[model samples]
Target: MERFKIRVIVTDQDVEKVALDVRPQTVEELKEIVRRHCNLQYEFNMMYEDPDFGNALCNLNNMDEVPAAATVKVVPLITSVSPEVTSNSSDISISSADTVILPSSSRTQGWPEVFSIPNFSVDVEFRLRQANLAYLKDNKTFKCPWDIKRNILQVLSEEIYKFDTYPDENRLHEVARALIGKHPCLTEAGCTDGCSGWKNSLYYKMGNFRTKLRKAGCAEVSINSSKNTPGVSKGLKRPKRCEVNFLPELPEREETLEAVRFLLAEEMKKKNPNATTVASKMDQTFSLRRREIVDVETPVETLKERWPALFTERQVFSEFNRIAATNLNDFFEALDRYTPKFVSIFKTKGGGVGETLTEFLQQIDLRKQDVTALRTLVLRGLPVLLGDDPSDFYKTCSVTDDDGVWAQVSIGLLTVVDEDAPVGPNVIHLEPVSTAIIIEGSVIMDDLKSLPEALCILFGLSYALHLDYPKSMKNTLNFIQKVMLGLGHNKLPPKLQSLKNVLLS
Candidate 1:
């Protein structure tokens, strides 16, 4: 057996040499050996010089690939390193000026879980490094300067905006907690959790930050400004569900609002407009349309006149993709995937709702039903099962009275059933059933093939036109938003969680 000597570098001053009797097959095996020899406890990455690339330091993944007398550098994965920790090796040097490498775990465990925080400015990084050093060296709480705190808040607010335009208290707390977790030196000594004060500061900072963003023509924040939402509260115009791009900023270096509007109008005039171009233009003008609908509260008719392309099915899906950052096809696929499980769960119930669900199931041939019909059953049955009154959302009426029935519904499925078909207490044989989406007492989309399609279009219109979920179908809509679409940021409500548990089980 031959022994290979390897040099392990922890820091500029800390180096250890070890002899290996047999070559380690994997990186983990080598890491274990280095960790034992150096007594290293912190998570770190091992970098070895690659002779092929001017001996540049590269991540050590395969131990067998290491050169015969390679020197490995151990880089601790830390967010804020104390200034006392120094590195002098030319390949990997650490200084007060360089940005500290953040731990990979922080990406999953840190605040604003949906979005990653942007790198802090060099000045802010220097301040954080100093704060960490002072706290570690003096063994006393370090107070962050006001300017540094402000800059930190600014960076955090920008990242939060990517996930939500107006983050609520819960969201704010997550950011605060993450800050302290990453840099314990910044924790407030007076607070019980050491983060409450930070959370409060973040709340106020976010308000001011939104104001600044609004001034900069950020449509997402501007739509909720005091001037835009009158008589209504700040949250009224904000996204009720987790909408990642509820109203994104206008495209960079694109045409002005008026110019985009002109281009959009011109595009609508073409008999065979390019779909790729149309989608691109529609994406560019999303924020503007959102402003008109949410801020101006423009009437649907007026909006249709102004943005004719928006009412089309293609644009409706496109607008939904922009708001939720999800594809409609994936949404339907999820709905279908869970339909059988949902039906099984619904069958176990034993109440008025259960009986209703049973009737619904009886009407449909579960084994032979198409995906559309299965989805329709799931979408319609969900409201009833969730205790949300579906009388208003999924209304059934004869062909003669559908117009009156549809007119009464603000937003929901208007199923036109056959008048002559056999009707039971809660069962109506749907033959050649037709479903339409009623928005603001108007059928914006008619002859929808399935109730699920109508529901999808209605959900999209809620974001596209800035309409609220109808009071009667709030729970069902919330289920689709949170569970089906997977847009929720918080824990599911009791009933929703219960259903989710069963579905997963």
Candidate 2:
């Protein structure tokens, strides 16, 4: 059994040691155990300095191969939004002249996740060469030369002034570390783990960077600036980290509809004999008719009230169900394409050999067929199949090849009373179900239609499913309410219109 231990560092400057047994458990299990023991947030990520690759994202997939007694850092994610900077000077302060110890809390605010930064690409070798930072030729001691550090600071000074606002201290640390790690000489100085010596060195560089910018007549706001004090972010309050609700003004409904109609009219009039003459006349009229673009600034509540049918989730789902059921055969066929083996079985042998639909019906005494069992199976299975229950794996057959699709085979057998003449469709007399049973059937059918079937099932089942319903379908659910009701006025091809009406009714 391969066994190893690692030092785990938390964001709150706490450290713990964790042992790993790679023979039995995977790296994912190791992370879970570490996460639970450390009390880290679920969203927190892990990183390590590989002997071969330097600093890299932890490969939880191959923890067994990692050398024993390695150290890993648990870094908090810097969300891709404006972060709140504390007003307390002592909490975060950068000296204008010399080195300062960066308060541990300062790392909490910078963009730590490198990938989130727009256009960020690290070319460590080029950076090291350009900065005069030394690389290990053999087994040399990891020490970043002073001249290299001074040159790096000079570069940082130029880079700082180019920024519109003061860069976050954590961002500077990350940027410095990226360059530092490439130079193997900086490893002993603790650049890989973002050591105190390296951090202090980076901070002094930033202090000089800020000082140079100030002296060059380019005044800059520091990240530690008080929100109450007037500066670059005078009226700027840190935006609340709530769900983003962007409200972009859109062209007015009437004008957009007119534009669509104008384009559609051009297409329709193209087949006319005097096409060129008509086209010019239509273009002239359309130009004259076009008005200034008005923007929709209506409240959501008002818009929902204006078009109640489009806004309600339940109603839209119901419509989708109704639309799907209109061409039920096509819908099932689409669903069948998703299950090729099952379809092949049905198509070749009428059903699976021994458990065939014909065999089940043959054994059934029409005089005493269990209606209760049939109804219970469907009622119980349909919802569980459509719902979010992971354990409902057994309910796969209820929606696909059930009575909804096999209506001719199953319903026909239920109607047949005589056992001798097994295949007489016209003479079969299905016993009268109670009005309650009929209603139950209707309810189950309704629920079946409203099911959130997969997109493949919708499209693969029928070509007719591709009919243009509305512009709302192009975007995600959030945009549904924003789509103008007038845009839905485009007449769906006859088949889609019928399907849509079934739901509306």
Candidate 3:
């Protein structure tokens, strides 16, 4: 390895001298050394005199270009406004070759003696006290150092008078503009045409440096930890809202669940315990509908892991799907059978028959009788698929059609259903209604002045259920329409009337 002796000079004063066996790899390493020796809050431009090029900073990246011995001059980007020490101090040199240099004032609080800026040569000390910036007085071109890019923060922390402690956010804009006006270098890059975009830069710089000073024990006590610290609010929390599921809770379809369980048990009797072999078999079995069921979680993964032998040649997945499909098909058949009976009940309650979704919506008025009749009929039909009462989940957000009622309903559904978590057989279509409504963008509005109560409930439920279980609820919507047509001012049956009262009341 090559070796070089180097001398670092700060503003014409010798600050450091060292012998290096390994040359610095990048300009940043040189900057780091300068920071260690000079305690400079702002960055410096490390320039050297080149024998052939006259004067310039050597790119350390190309080792062949560097000389055996070099003299590096440190030029501060943002010169200190005032020196803490007088110009004639001979003890300005900090000669410890390996010790890290820190600002004299950086010592933690309670030292009894307040530390300020360290002394420097008379020339450098006097130059800082003058009104003009050091670079401008020397007529040198601006070499914008990365570190000094945001040093305005340190200036505001140490020099600004109105701020007795850390400045509040309210004064940030004013301070930023003032600092930019005072120091031209603080102006944002590419803003040379009378536009100084330094406000954001100064604001962020000051905010970060304030925190740094506090952690370094250099921040003022008044602004450090007061309860009434400006720009910060204490003891505030986010507001809470009452949330209820829009889909009602229903009794479990025990017979249907039992059938599904029975199918799985039969499949387990045939399948091998090996997970890999069973997974391969399933992959081949569902090749046609593979895409649809690809992401579906295998509910039997735990059982397969614990007792892989029971799954030997098992048709668990196929049988479960077959049973579920059969149950769903049976539900549609029942809807076909019981639909006419419900239609008879609806007609006796005085609801109008509508051919289209729009017609149904326009006719439904928000009368107690109309709402009760429609709600009762829909709830009755819901049991065909759900096999239980869904009244509890009928809650909705305050927002109506315009704001998208399904949005709130979906949120409620997600809260109730942990889709990622494993569930047992009792988990019935967790968000069927809400999921369908969300995808279809359907909602029910209580617009008594324009829309009718019977039609609103009819279309709302029909659209939601039809979208949720398209194949199973295919004819259910038409059944609702027929029921509405049959309702023609005849008195409601006593059972339906009581049910209507339960809904509307």
Q: Pick the candidate with the highest TM-score.
A: 1
Candidate 3 residue-wise lDDT at 454? 24
Quick one: ranking by TM-score, best first?
1, 2, 3
Give the alpha carbon lDDT tens digit for every residue of 93-174 in model 3: 2221111121322111111112232333333334333423643576333444443333323434443321223333434445
Models 1 onward score TM values of 0.69, 0.22, 0.20
lDDT leader: 1
Runs off by more than 4 Å, candidate 2 = 1-135, 160-164, 189-196, 219-505
The CA-based lDDT of model 1 is what? 0.70
Task: Report the error of model 3 at residue 269, Å.
Answer: 89
Return the clash pairs for model 2, or none. 143-185, 334-461, 415-430
In candidate 3, stretches whose alpha carbon ends up further than 4 angstroms from where it belongs are 1-153, 161-170, 183-197, 218-505
Model 3: lDDT to the true structure? 0.36
lDDT of 1 by residue, 342-438 (tens): 8887789888888888988887887787677677678768888777887777767667674776687788777776777553335533444677777
Q: Which window of 10 residues has the lowest lDDT sum in candidate 1?
A: 101-110
Candidate 1 Cα errors over 4 Å, as ranges = 1-117, 130-141, 214-236, 247-273, 398-402, 417-419, 422-425, 428-433
